[model samples]
Target: MKAAVLFETGKPLQVVDGVQIPELLQGQVLVDVHYSGLCHSQLAEVRGHRGEDRWVPHLLGHEAVGTVSAVGAGVSKVATGDKVVLGWIKGEGQDVPGARYPLVKDGKEYLLNSGGVTTFSEQTIASENRLVKLPDGMPDKLAVLLGCALPTGMGLVFNEAKLLPDALESQGKSIAVFGLGGVGLSALIAAYTTQPKVLIAIDVEAHKLELAKKLGATHTIDLSTENWQEALQAICPGGVDYSFEAGGKAETIEMAFEAVRDAGGQCIFASHPKEGEMIRLEPHAFHRGKSIRGSWGGGSQPDRDIPLFVELYKAGKLPNLELLLSHEYSLDEINQALDDLEARKITRALIKIAGE
Candidate 1:
């Protein structure tokens, strides 16, 4: 198998071929990856934003679509030859440890670390719980999004914020989505279904803002310009009913919190800042019924929520879901894909690991 190995922090991944696949432990499933979605979380790790990288020379990738090639002993959630969506979220299956591979390069032995699931390789040994069987005929590319971006973004709106159908039709309800990445755009798509009178999209990139408008944003704000907050305030004088932060920056998280109305407003941030960075907020805001919270994969249950999301997408509720995928790359071009994501040149980059 060929895998992109992260041998060091702040360095490009080393694409190594002829890598040996480790034997599957109990409750593990071997998958032949077809398409893998490069997420911001992986970028954060590569950039050393998440603190010390103890697991160097490891595989990285959490969302992908693949076919089950084999299952280890005691595994029954998915069978061989089953097309499935692989995610980091834990589902109904036996809990097991991650896989570790021993590779020899230039006569030097190195260990590769990985969680129960990783998708940045032609083949991966994922825990049984990380695999979700896909519906028949589901596009492999689209199903990749269901692993993380769709689940997390849609989960924030449907589960975390608990925005009811009536609230969206209330006319007074307003929503502001900060950052136009895959997760942010997914939130916008989900929020748009509610039909809020005021839907604001904020981003530093003009192209992302333009795309947001076409995807049902009533207003768009470019953060690169000065006084963007003032413009946002003008649109929602009392502040928006809800605000979402997906930029993975502390400053953006603060802005999302401040964009909400002082009373009965909720702010949710799915992205996390680098270690040692903190988001400051007014202590008095809590008294006014304003609250802020972090989301873990939008509190998604892979077994339940993914199927629901598929139904919504098929029903035309999530219009332009494909728009979230901006670029495609081969397994060897993984570094360029990461660069494009960091440069804001693409929303979500899909890496074609193997033919579907």
Candidate 2:
């Protein structure tokens, strides 16, 4: 199999051929990955932003849509020939360690590291718990977002914020989202379904903010010049009912927290910045009914949420879903994809694997 190998931190991934696939363990499943999504997390790993380098020479990627070719012992969640979405979030099935692939690079042979789920390669060995059966009629490219971006982004709204339905309340709620990346946009789309009285999208780029407006954000704030908190307050007096942050920076997270109403307002952040960085919050804010918390994959349960997302997509709730896939690349151009992602050249990049 051909795969992109991260031989070292702070360096470009080496796309090597003739890599030997490892034997499946007790709960591993081999997948023929069709399309993989490039996320900011992968860029953090390659740039050493996550800190530490013990897992060098490992496979990197946690979201993709693929077809199962084989299953290991003790695996029952999926069977051979089953189409599935691979993700990092664990679900039903046995939990197992990641698979290591043996490959020869520059006259040197070594084992490549991977997690329970990885999608950077054309063929990957993923644990059964990381696999979610893909729903029928979903496009291959769009389904890839279900693995991470949708789950995490939409999860921020559905799971974390738990936004009330318009029918449940007399008036629509107000909300704001910091950052217009894939995850942020996902949250914005989900929040839109609630018919919020005010929905604001904040970002440094003009194009992303414009896309947000088209995706149902009632207002957009440019962080490059405007003060987000002041701009948000101007749109909706006082503050919003909820704030979701995915700016991948601590300052933005703090800004998200401060953009919400002090009474019963919630702030949830899903981005992971570099290690050693800390977010400082006001200690007395808890008394005011303001709350802040971190999200784990938007608190998603793949077995349940993935199917619901498919239904929502089919119902036209996610009408602008294709706009989120901002760029496309091949497996060989994986490094360039990462570079473009880091440079903010695209919203979310899709890497064509076996199905290309």
Candidate 3:
């Protein structure tokens, strides 16, 4: 198998060939990867933002779509030839550990490590829990987003915010999303589906903000040019009913929390800062009914939510969802994709592995 291996943290991934795939263990599924989506999590992993690299020389990637070529012992969530969406989020299946691939260097054999799910390779050994069977005829590229971006984004609004399309208040809810990455824009799109009275998108880039508008943001705030709190305040006097933070910064997390209305407003942050980083907030705000919480994959259940997300996309409820994937890079260009993601040059970069 061919794969982009992370030999070291804070370094470029080495696109290597002939990395040997070992026999699948219990609860594992062998997938021929079709497409992978790059997001901030991969950037953080490559940049060593999470503090340590104990998993060096490992496969990197979480969200992807692929075909099941084989199944391991005791695995029954999916079958051979089943098209599936590979994700980091756990679902109902046999829980298992990461896989190790064999690599030969100058006749010296080495082992490459991988998590329960990885996509930056032509083929991967994923735990059954990380696999979600995709429906027949679904676009592989778009389904790639289901693994992470859409699940987390839509989950933030649906699961965390509990904002249902038909349950919106008569006046509608006021919502604000801080950041414009794939996850943030996804939340923005989900929030839009509820017909929110005010949907504000905040970002440092003009292009992302513009895309937010087209995707359904009633207003856009340029963090580089304006104070987001003031801008948000000007748009919604009493603060928004919900604020979602995906900026991956402590300051933004604090700001997102503070932007919520004092009475029953909620703030949910899907991004995490570097390990050991701290976010400070006023404790008194909790007394006034303002609440903040961090989301784990937007509280998504891959097996359950991915199907719903697919249905919504098919129904055209998530209009222009394809626009969220702003760039595509071949598997060989994985390093460049990471660089662009870190530089905030693209909303989402698709990694074309073995997809048609």
Candidate 4:
């Protein structure tokens, strides 16, 4: 198998071929990866943003679409030849530890660490619970989004924000999505389904904000421009009913929290800032009924929510799934993909591991 090995933090991943797949432990499933989504989380890990790398020379990737080749004992969630969407979120099935692969380089043996699910390899060993069987006829590229971006973004709106359909239809209900990345755009697409009176998209990139408008943002604010917050306030008047921060920066998170209305507005941020950094907000804001919190993969349950998101996409509710994919790269070009992500040159990069 070919895999991108992260041998050290703050260094490019080494594309190593002829890597041996470890034996499947109990509750593990071997999968032939088809397509994997490159997320900012991986970038953080590679750049040493999350602190010391105890798991050096490990595999990194959380979302992908693959076909099950084999399953270990006690694995009932999937079978051989079944197509599945692999994710980091735990689902129904046995909870098992991650797999460790052994590889030899320059006549020396080294071990590679991996979580329950990783997609940076041509072949991967995923825990049974990390795999979700895909609906027949779903495209592998689109299914890849369900593993992370779609679920986390849509989940933030549907689950954490708890924005019911009726609530969205209510007159004067407004939403502000901070950072027009994959998750932010996904939140905008999902929030638009509710038909909120106001949908504001904020970002430093004009292209992303433009895309957000096409995806149903009623208003767009470029953070790079002066008085962008003033522009947002002019449109939203008394702040928004809800706000979502996906930029993974402390400043953006603080802005999202402050952009909510004083009473009954909610702010949710799925991005994790660098370790040792903190977000400071007005202490008196909480007393006014405004709330701010973090999200865990948008509080998604892979078995239940992934299917629902697919159904919605199938029904034309999510028209921008393909638009979210700005670029695609092969396993060997993984470093370039990460560079593009860090440069904000792409919304989401899809790593093609195998044929459709």
Index of the highest-lDDT prediction: 3
Q: Please, what are the lDDT tens digits per residue for candidate 3 over residues 1-356?
A: 88999898988999989999899899999999999999999889888999778977889999999999999999988999999999999999998998999999778788999999999999999999999999754589889999999999999998987886656362388899998999999999899888888999999999999999999999999999997778888999979899999999998999899999998999999997998899999999999999999999999998889888888888888899989999999999989989898888999999998868
TM-score of every candidate relative to the true structure:
0.97, 0.97, 0.98, 0.98
Q: Candidate 2 overall Cα lDDT vs. reference?
A: 0.90
**Backbone clashes, each candidate:** 0, 0, 0, 0
lDDT score of residue 249 within candidate 4: 94
Q: What tens digits encode model 4's per-residue C-alpha lDDT throughout 1-356?
A: 99998999999999998788878999999999999999899999999999978988889999999999999998988999999999988899988888998898999998889888889999999988898999865699989998999889989998897775446344357999998778888888888887788999999999998899889889898889858668977998879999988988999999999999998889999998898889999999999989999999999999999888878877888876788999999998999999999999999999998977
Against the reference, the lDDT scores of all candidates come to 0.90, 0.90, 0.91, 0.90
lDDT at 175, model 4: 92
lDDT of candidate 2 over 90-121, digit per residue (tens): 99999999998988877998999999999999
List the candidate 2 regions with Cα displacement exceeding 4 Å. 164-167
True lDDT of residue 11, candidate 4: 96
Q: What is the lDDT of candidate 1?
A: 0.90
Give lDDT tens digits, candidate 1, residues 1-356: 89998999989999998788888889999999999999889998888888768989878999999999999999989999999999998988987888988889988988799988899999999999998899864589989999999889888888898764336344446999998899999999888887788999999999999999888899999999857679988999978999988988999999999899987999999997888998899989999989999999999999998888888777778878888888999999999999999888999999999875
> Alpha carbon lDDT of residue 214, candidate 1?
82
